[model samples]
Target: MQKKSGLRGIHAGWYAVVCVLVLGLVALVLYGSGAYDSWRDGRSLDQACDGALAQDGLTSALGSSHLKAEDGDDGSLAGCFVKTSPGTGRAVRVTLRWSTDGAPSGSLVWYNADTLGVREQAAPLGNGWSGVVRYDGTWQIMVALDCANQKNKALVAYGDLYGASSGTALTGLGRVTTETAKKAAAQHGCQVKAGKRLTRVSTARLGEPGTAKPLGQAQGSCVALRDVPGAQSGTPEIMEYPADPDAPQTNCYLATSAKKPGYGLYAYYGAAAKDFESVGFGHPGGDYVLATAPCPRSTHEAAFALYRLYDRDTGNYPVPHYSDSFARSALKAFAEHEAEQRGCGEVRIMSAP
Candidate 1:
């Protein structure tokens, strides 16, 4: 199945954490060199959701008429996002599939808020799992199948989201998911066991918190990111190390809420060196919004700093700016704090590392 796609509570088992920490750093360095962004150019969003309404089994089964849909593939993801005619409020419907055929090991199969769990109701998708997740005013009905074709094995999931009041919400969506899973199973020649239900997942095991949550509580190395002055809280971004194992993770506490939209407070621990630009921010003619200083520790320290980018061309995020003074000040404050913690040098206009 194709579909796509953190740190901070990182204090226990120092040795194990360090190894993973280094790996995480290596990944971030590559990311800094521009290996981030999982979405690659591909079929237009329309192509991704090619048969959304007309060809989908769920719509007719659910008695959803006059519904509208849009779908597409973004390198790693492919699916349709739908809303009823005159879609309004939080009510919506979505169908997503990872476009990638070969997902690397350790890739996540389910994510987003209000995680899904299994409940017994019916068995339609022969040989997989069925679950449901309800949150706010919306709910998602999900199904996954283990389709193996002699050699390669793939796990594919199908889901539907809708208001709880829809008549066939349960029965129809479940049947549609089962039908879709059957088609998918046959496509991959994998067996599906009818009526097999997943064990209930505990509420205690809510979805894993990642960058989408508040940066303050999101995980990080050394110290968690505290609230920044004059900034609305935004999600922290965790750059994972793609090297075989996790190590040296880079936890970026974004102050995107910084009266400006692109300010981010990046912290990375586990062995790493500072690049000249990061190390040379305060000097004449260096980056205007970027700055960095070495974290005091020889092993685990926050040495990297960056002023996150907001592409005006995409008009994606609100345009943001951080004065050279503010950026430098933040870096200086961060470095001084690190020195005190690691018993290193007094913070000054730090020299190039």
Candidate 2:
């Protein structure tokens, strides 16, 4: 009987030991099968959250008053706000970058209170890249990844910035102001207007047909020679004459009319002293005149002459003369002035006559 009892106890002990060992094996199998690794592999949520939080901290450090972040798919992050940097006025800037391994590719999208649309992405720079879409008006930006190989993936980062009204990134404000002033002067009649109609003249003092001559000699005693204002700059007004005797004669004469106190330096021409008479005396006929008046300076005089010469040679008025050296110089000055007036960078002259 004693032996049977001892045997039963030992059997019970063995059974208990076997049960404990089986339970330990089950636990080991469960642990090894990755029940915990599923959660570990899915820890991308924690990484994304941490990234967003870190970006917020960085933006705050940069003096951004309003900072916000949002999580996106595949380890992407985005943020936006108004920056407090001085001189930046109500401006918006956006940036996006993404990376991928092997054949990595990604995309970015943005929307504001005004417009919502997918913007075109620029080529990536460095490991990741940043770009600005619009700076002056409303803002939008997008980034993308090149996933050439399906095995590769990407992480996208995006940021938007708004600020106060800052001036343009270009230069030359002074030039623009000066040009505007000049235009205003012209409009106000601070300069003389070019003649709309010409007078014909006939006289001996005038040079032969098709020949250019001095106006002071052509007009003689009929009109007094007077220094025209705005001539100091070498842009003297010229008077042109026809060399033909039988053709309607004309004398070149500078206009002294100054409604706004400006002057036109001009030259006159005639066939004979008598032809010069009508022009100087404001006669109805017998004078031929070509004139350029009320320009900024004499540098443009040669250009004007070349323009007329080109027209005469080509049988076309206002012939374009950009290739000519004289025209180019004048055009350069004009372009600079224009750029100054329009508040733009260096003005480029595409074509001129």
Q: Output the number of the lDDT-best candidate.
A: 1
lDDT of candidate 1 over 1-353, digit per residue (tens): 12321132333456688989999998888678644422221222123344332234444334454344455233322355545444443223334342124331211222111001111111122223433332333334444333333322323344555554443454445554445545555544566443433222122111224323343444333133344333333323322111110111222333233222244333323221221122232122223232234443232223444353343445543323445544565455544554454454444453322
Worst 10 residues of 1 by lDDT: 112-121
Q: Candidate 1: count the clashes.
A: 20
Instruction: Quote each prediction's TM-score.
Output: 0.30, 0.19
TM-score of model 1 relative to the true fold? 0.30
- The CA lDDT of each predicted structure is 0.36, 0.26
Best by TM-score: 1
How far is 170's C-alpha from truth in model 2 (Å)? 16
How far off is residue 204 in model 1, in Å?
17
Tell me the alpha-carbon RMSD of every candidate: 26.4, 28.4
In terms of lDDT, model 1 sits at: 0.36
Q: Give the Å shift of residue 201 in candidate 2.
A: 66
Q: Tens digit of lDDT per residue, candidate 2, span 1-353?
A: 99999999999999999999999998788779865444442343234333222222222223343322224333223322323233234322222222321111211111110011111111111112211122223222222222223222222223233432212211111111122222322333344211111111111121123333332343321122223233223322233332211111112322111101111111211111112222332221211122222212111111111122211223432222223443344334333332232233533333332
